[model samples]
Target chain A: MTRILADRAARLLDFLWSGWAGLAALALLFACWQAGHETWGDFILPDPLATLGATWSLAISSESRGLLLLTAQRALAGFTLAAFSGAVIGIIAGYAPAVMRLARPLLTVVLGVPPIAWIVLTMMWFGTSGATVAATILISATPVVFVAAAEGIASRDRGLGTMAEVFRYGALGRFWFIDLRQAAAPLFPALALALGTSFKVAVMAEMLANAGGVGGALARARAMLDVPQALAWVVLAVIALVVVEYGLIRPMQAEIEGWRRAAQPWGVKK
Target chain B: MSAALELHRIGHAYFGQSVLNSIDLQIAPGEVVALVGPSGSGKSTLAHIAAGLVEPREGRVTPGYARHAMIFQEPRLLPWATAAQNIGFALRRAKLPRRLRPARVAEAARLAELEPQDLAKYPVELSGGMRQRVAIARALAVRPDFIFFDEPFTALDVALKRRMQDLVIAAAEEAQFAALFITHDLVEALRIAHRIAVLDLRGRGIAGLRILPGDPGARDEATTFALRQRFLTEDPLFRHIHDVDERRRP
Candidate 1:
């Protein structure tokens, strides 16, 4: 139909606008990099061509691929543990005021401590393994999720809750229909932040622990004074972070938020 | 059958200040009763108590039927739920199987005159009138034996209000369920109520009760208007209350 064609056309226009904007931004970035490279010469700054060559070389190597996969595995494991435990503890704390009160001081203490402060203790406990690295990541991200979930539950509309009670919707039905739906919007942003924090903290923990992963490769490259290779690994890590964020976390968020999208703008038309 | 609802000297207070005192009322099955009073006169409080949302501190409220539902002053639809989903919430606890819920929801939506496209929309997406209709649909979906309306059409425009009033009358006629409708609008109260109960703000018991004589279906506008004037002036209590409300109006 004509309406469908118009909708498709509008979508295509939005896509083109996004693509052009990104291209313009990238061009500006490349110009800055080229100018910096020229001023500093080869030792302090590598040319774009040289950086790309180094990145390609690293990408094709079997050892680099294994290191990348290992780093990804550690991030996934730590993020999974944090998300599962955080959601369970958060829901319980949200619903029960007594439990929330009991846990408040402890949660504050845990959230305030720097990641470095816990790194030595984690290393002492787990002895320079992936487990220690993962523990540090989990400890760093769980509080964010807890706060969001708790606030969401606290502010639910009491009138709707009363309606639910009048309908004789038992505990489970009440939770699913009223409580969970109210909590989900706040929970998504917290989950996204936790996911991003997992990847960043995992890399930092791996580097500090001197574990066998991309961090170890970076450490070795630094020691050998292979600055270009070290920078290449950093670039690889950034790319991995972007990929994981967009590919994994974003899709999950979209799936969870589909209902919200369908709700759309209700009032006056713009 | 006994009266659909009975209130035995019901009284309520907040912070030692009495809102309702020694109230006694009874509504028969398939009857519509309108409770009209000034602001802060405890009309809404009585409705809430009758619907079992709030319990009175003193005396008993006995409903002849077990099932009851309410429509508040505001629509009070859940922001997160679609029109269909919100209506379905009222039937969520029903004894019907899962597959029958959609049909029941559809039936209520139809009764409320909700359009197909609007059914998939959220409360925020609808206009004030549309949202009010959804709220009405939700209450009807429960198939309650008793219904309470607390100024349910206050936010609507004149045409929409008339449409909603007709819908309420139509529903009551079809279902034969008892209703306690609270409103400050005399015209609205007269149009729908089988009997009108005027509350004395200074005292607790009903000041007066007027039983309307002709069938709503057969009555014309002039007859209804004349009846409204007769109730306002011929009844001594109504005359005093109307003068006081007019004096108090800013």
Candidate 2:
């Protein structure tokens, strides 16, 4: 038990140390943003500091904070729906080739249709509500997770399956312990991609449907030509994405992928 | 006396191509029987059939043992799990109480000669030999009366292979488990198996069986080498053991 705790503590420290690289990358991005602001002046692109000030003011106000919460809820709800259903269907399709064959064309059709079209359609179907935003996000994100999970299951090592069979693992037991565990390698990356898509589509649907969220706030800023406010809302949306990805997705990924880290020898760990 | 495992007219085919046909074999309790064959002789297929990993196209597998485990050609350890966890994986199937598992896992690890610190490491973090040790530990953890080894040490270097064979000999002797050890190497078969069964080139049947002079693990290296040389050079049953017919491999 002490060894496990110590290992977790070491991993936590390693995670914190890795944040320096992330900060360095963020600084580089900010430098490029500053360059663009200087090139275009205040009319086209606002300076990063001004945008930060606007973001801080917006974040401090109760009204804008509520809007942010609404958007986060919509994104999370839609993401949950997509993750669950897509993973189930994908896993089923993965095990059954006929179902996979059927799902392929359907996935192609769903992916081929643009997210803007879905947003427009969902707006008509669900009106200017959270449902519209959520439906749009689901339509846009489900296929990514579906494809990922399906491929993950399809490519699993059959040797492991045989090994499980030798141990007398039943169908459900093998699926739970071996197949699903193997599928997680590809599934996690797909989930991360799907999550990003969810948030993006959520905000886009909200803007188009006039739902009261950060996207609606951005639309208002656009109407008034408040570039700094618009940039602030964009920044807020990005911060929310980073928070969800790093806060939820990355920690879970780290826990599952520790073996991958162990594969790397000492003095070469990143 | 009842045999530990009995294969009566066991036959199997893949995609209508018969790979194993009308093979009959039996292992007494606490005996290590080595099954040696050419590359395409369906040795692994027969082992898989005996272990119940594959359904035979015909015939029955009557397993008289309480439980059985297998160690495959590759380590086949779950890469995501620690070495200890890999051993515990089999223990989970054994249905031992959850709290008692750690001790069982540690005991099996010790039997496999793995270091205490190595238990926490993943398969990829360990050396190739260590990875195979984890596989052996996994098989041993189940505490079965019967075990199947499908060329478990075929991938190891010469020295490592000998060590693993010795480990298996020690494990089987200590546990008194009946084993069907499949190998292409005659020396390996001689060193580890009490009796050697030569499989036919076309999987027609068990070609022949030879009982070695002394018990397994008691035979010296010089005797094993001499027996191996005699089998390869003089024994007609082993004439096709070293042959590689890729076209006929199932």
Candidate 3:
């Protein structure tokens, strides 16, 4: 039908339009790379197209796919665990100011310690295993989610609680439906940030600890002084980050916040 | 039948300053009593006391009947809930069977003049009038024996206010629900209330009560306007109210 075709066209337009800003940023990065390429002459930085071709080949290869998968799996596992624990503790802390005050110092200390330091400590304990990579990511990302969820819970609309009470909605019903709905808004942006952190920490841990992932592959490329290949692995990791964030997280945000679409200027009522 | 609600010698104070002093009022079954007062006359505090929202320091409320509800000045709808879901929330509290909730919500929505398409929209998606209608629908969904109207239509425009008042009057008649309507608008009080109970601004308790003559919710705009003019001339509170209005009307 013409309607179906029109809908598909509109969706395609939306998809392309959403990527325009990212494309512009990538163009800027490429320009910087071109300047360096012109200066170093294919030894230090290499041509952007050479790195793009290397990334394309890496994308096609089974070994590189496995390395990408390993890194993704570790990052996601750590993020899931952190999200669960952080939301629980953060919600409790939000309701109890004493708990938040007590935890503030500890949270600052944990967040201030760099991911590299956590990687070193985790490596000493887990010794170049996937566990070290997961541990490092959990440490680096959990605090961001916790702080966001806590702040969200603390600042939720107070009228909703009273409204729920007037309706005589049970305690559990009020908490799960009303309280959680308000908290989820801010928590989601923090979650996106944490997911990015998880990826960064995972790759860093893999390279430093010799864990088998994209970071390990990047280490191999670095030792061989294959500039394009090294850039190719970096590009592949970034591609993974962009794909997960845009593909998974963005759609969920759109669905939950769909009510805002109605707030847009309608111009004329239907 | 027993009285629907009774407030016996209710007295309250915030930080030792008396807001309500030995306030007493009663609502018979199916009666609509409007509580009228100027700002800071403890009209809201008395309404809250009657609804058991805030406990009266000196007396008590006897909510004799089951399934009472309140419609506040603000819509106070849960933003996350769709219109139908918000109505369904009230049905749940009314203890309708889970399977029957959707039907009852739809029926209440019909009574409140909410369209079916609006049922799926969240509070943020609804207009100011539509959101108030949703709140009205939620209050009426339970088919309650009593409802407290705490100046619920103040935010609405004149047309919307009339519409909402009509809905409340219709619901009150059809369900025979007792209501304690609170407002500063004398015309609105006259429109929806069977009798007006005026709260004294210079003091803490009710000053007078006036009963109106007519079938409630009947579209007698001329009759209501006549009664409103009489109130402006005769009622002390309304005369005081008119003096303020007289100064402002240029």
Candidate 4:
């Protein structure tokens, strides 16, 4: 028990330390943004400070915060739907090669149709509502998760399955203990990608459909030619993406794949 | 008493090509039998069949033991789990209470010569030999009445292989369990098995069976070497044991 607690503590520390690197990367992006603002002048690209000021003002307002929350809710709801259904179908297809083969063409077709096209289609179907935004995110994000999960399961070590069989682990036990554990290594990354897609698609759908969200706010800023406000909203959307990815997805990945960290030597940890 | 395992006329083929045919073998309780064959000679297929990992295309496998475990050529340890967790996984099948599982894992780790510190390490953290040790501990933790070894130590260095064979001999003696140990190495078979059954090159059947002198662990190094030498040089049944048929799967 003490060992587990100590390990968890160590991982927490490691994660916190890695945030310094993230901060450095963000600083580099800020430098690039400052250079671009100077090069293009205030008309085309707003200075970093002006955008920050706009971001702070927007953040302090209750209406803009509600809009951000609404967009996050729509994205998360669509992501949850996609993740659950994609994982289930993918796992079943993974165990059955014929099913996987049949799903491959369909996955390609779904992937080939852009998120914008889905937004247009869904806007027509749901008529410019939250459901339209959610449906677009769902269609755009599920393929990535499905493909990753299928590949993960398809490529698992068959030797482990035989070992489980020898030990008399039932079908359910083997699936739970061996198959799912192996599949998780690939599944987590796909989930992260799908989440990013969900947010992007949600915002795109909201903008195209003229729904009320961060995307809708951005549309209004564009109509009024409020460049700094539009950039600020974009920044807010990115911050939300980073929070969901690092805060939720990464921690779950670290917990599931702790053994991978053990495999690395001390110098390789960072 | 009934035999611990009985494989009657076991026949199996992959993709319409027969790899094992009419193979008959039996192991009495507390006996260690080595099935020796060349690469791609269906030794592993037969072991898998007897262990119920594969369904025989044309025969019956009657396992009289209470429970059985297997140690494959690779460690086959769950890379995501710690060594202790891997061993504890097998104890789950034994239906030991959850509270007692740690102690049982520790006991089996000790039996496999795994140290306390090593039990907390994942399989990827351990060396190749240590990973195989974890696999052995996993098998031992189940307290199986029978065990199947499908070339469990072929990947190890010579010294490591000897140490692993000694560990198995010691564990088998202490537990008095029956095992079907499949190997291509005659010395390994001589050192660990009470009886060595030579499998035919073409997978027709068990070519012959030889009962070795003395018990498995009691045999000296010199005795094992000489017996292996005699079997390789003089025994006609072992002529194909070293022969590799290039066409078949290794």
Candidate 5:
């Protein structure tokens, strides 16, 4: 019971600190915006306050909310598909040197081809539907996850293998409990990168394919010379990225990797 | 019963470098035998061979006992796991009832003199001595008939090393687990071992053996001092150890 309370208190403290960090980040962003505004004027880079106002307007519009939801679902679906497949395949490849060697060239090829190039092929296959956007997101994001997971698995401590043998952990028990725990921290940067990639690719795919979402709205804003609205949609997409990456992934990370916190010193060393 | 662990004519080499050659040894149940030698005498290789971690290139390693555990040079704890969880990890193969694991883990911690509060903390949170204690507890928790120590106390400070030596002697007394303790430190071998086997640095194997005078755990300071004096003055291996050091001078 006390442990439970301590956990909650730690989480609550993390959230509070994160909240403060977000505000500090926003303050820095505003300074950059102010500088950019002075050089380029409102035509190229609209006032930061104006972009916020435009974002507020989008938040209030029911149509915009639906578009937001659609884009978010596509990005999330792609990220989920990529994260699972990448982690599974990467782990399998990690164990089998032959598989890893074969997959290396394929991974490079897949990652090397730009997402923009894939959008045209996806459009031809999926006919500008949500499928096109999802496919684009997948092609663009999967290699990042795959590469990260493979490295994580490769870098795991071999000493633990002897420990596992001595302790009598079965193959499955070692994989699930020990091997996966060892891989957790290394997988984090990959998962985060894949997430950010999904959002960017989804938006790009939506713009090119003309699927209904904030991306379509962004396309219309671009056509009509509504710079603030275009910037507003970009802000909304970044907000969505932040929401999924932090609100969801980060909390799970805290739970899984909190032991690392104990290693950190609270004060400077003498 | 026969010896808990016996190695007959064990020989091994890496790429023909010949790390160990024609070694034979045995440990009876509840016996503490220390294998001591200079830096490159294959003490760890011998320990590993006895524990079945390494297959001897020649001869046989026979384990008469049902179970065995090892204390490595490093604590080798799972960094992500708490001390209790690390202990529990070792118990996974022991086939204990799921409901009873925590109690067993707690019992192991008590045996190792680990503080209950520290049990919940991860390896990174613990000091070196505490981590080593956790490793000791992990080895003891299995209640093995045989335990192999591969110079596990070398990293510890002098005081902590004595405490760990006492812990080993006490565990051997209470648990009756035969141990093949490996180290290069003559003083440490004398402190904890009933019998000390000296390994030949020149590949002759099993150079000599010495039986200390009294119970290892109960020996007085005077006895230890006298034993050291006798080793330095009379033991040919000890004389060679000193001579080897003298030979390295410019």
Candidate 6:
């Protein structure tokens, strides 16, 4: 019973160490915000409590809540479409040299074009709806994903591939064991970037399209010249980005990286 | 026993340069043939052609064996897989059912003398000799009719090398699998081979083939050492290699 109590105490210490570290960092950030509000005055920076009140009020409103959900839906749809299409094309371009040569120049052109330039054309085509926002996000995010997937396939170990061939690994086996494993290391980071970019592009596109979302809420706040309300909406968007990134994408990435680390020299031995 | 592998006047070139020219060889079932020469003497190229990993520019290779596998100079174990998993990879597509796969992997591990703890460890966690043993285990797990060893024990220490040599002889005796072992080490060739072929790089084909009169299984260190000395001094076919090395010495 004493040993069990000791084990529980040890685990509790580890739990406190991990969980409290984040809370401590958040407290430090709030302290800094409070200090800045006092120094900069209400016009430039709102008090922490006042900002929290505004954020809470805006968060509960029907229109603002709907806008947040709509933005999230747009981002998800665009990111999914981009990830799927990019992965397919990337795998083909990575494996086949002839296809890569033809596709590379076109992808470069697409990557180089600004998101704002594409917004005009997308708005004209889709007419300021969810489709227009999703299209903008897709156009912004696909190239980064494509480049990462192609590089991952190209850098795979040829020896392992040859070994796979000797074992008569059929198409599915080859892809699952060799191709996908090789591609995974680079693909995860690209997915993270694409996910983040989709959110930014969706919100930007929504703002310009005057579509119903957080961007539309920002527009209404701007029309009224309510600086604190506008700031609150911007803060909410940032919080959403952080939550999606750290809470969702980051943990998934950490899981993959942990698997990779275990497969590496030091981690496995330890 | 019939010939398990037959190569007739096989020729191969790399980027307009002839690496192997008019090479002819044959290995009977359960026979162990060792090909020895200096570096870049086309021994590896011949082995690669025989393994069907490379295409010959001329002549034909008739593979009478049903299955084949190779152990390269490096262990070439998959870094992502554990030792047991690496060996099991060879059995992944075999007709063996899932229930028997783990047993087969365990048997191969036992044959290779790998510890249970080592079996769960990744390649990077293993020593140089251990990794090579894992490679051998992987090859054996496939239950191939023919196997190729391309300087597979080059990186091992003397004791580890001798142990691996014994393992190969034992495995070959038990399984009756023909092997084409390539190496520059005359001592290694004498310890493992039934017949030794000297590849003549200057002459563009096999210069000499000597069938050793004794069994590899019964040969002791004295006999192996004697054979090694004979290969260096008395073997006319290997004189050129000795002379080249002597000239290159500072």
What tens digits encode model 5's per-residue C-alpha lDDT throughout A25-63? 989999999899989999999989999999999999999
In model 6, how many backbone clashes occur? Answer: 0
Write the candidate numbers in order of decreasing lDDT.
Answer: 4, 2, 5, 3, 6, 1
User: Candidate 1 docking: what grade?
Assistant: acceptable
Q: Rate the local accuracy (lDDT) of all candidates.
A: 0.81, 0.90, 0.83, 0.91, 0.85, 0.82
Using Cα atoms, each model's DockQ against the true complex is 0.37, 0.65, 0.41, 0.65, 0.42, 0.37
**Tens-digit per-residue lDDT, B92-192, candidate 1:** 67776788998888888888889978987778778899999999889888788888999898888899998999888888887677899998777888888
For model 5, give the TM-score of chain B.
0.95
Scanning candidate 5 chain A in windows of ten residues, the lowest lDDT window is: A261-270
User: What does candidate 6's lDDT look like per residue over B45-132, in tens digits?
Assistant: 7888888878899879998898888898888777767789899998987667888998989888888888888887777778898998
True contacts preserved, each candidate?
A: 0.36, 0.82, 0.46, 0.82, 0.51, 0.23
Model 2 per-residue lDDT at A9: 94
Ranking by TM-score: 4, 2, 5, 6, 3, 1
Please, what is the TM-score per model?
0.84, 0.97, 0.85, 0.97, 0.90, 0.88
- Pairs clashing within candidate 4: none
**Candidate 6's error at B162, in angstroms?**
3.5
Candidate 5 local lDDT, B12-80, one digit each (tens):
887877878888888888888999877766788888777776788898998888888999889999887
Off by over 4 Å in 3: A1-40, A104-106, A124-127, A266-270, B15-18, B55-58, B97-99, B200-203, B218-226, B229-233, B236-250
Clashing pairs in 5: none
Off by over 4 Å in 5: A34-42, A96-109, A267-270, B202-205, B237-250
Locate the minimum summed-lDDT window of 10 residues in model 6 chain A.
Answer: A261-270
How much lDDT does candidate 3 score? 0.83
lDDT of 4: 0.91
Candidate 2, residue A173: the lDDT equals 85
TM-score, chain A only, candidate 1, equals 0.83
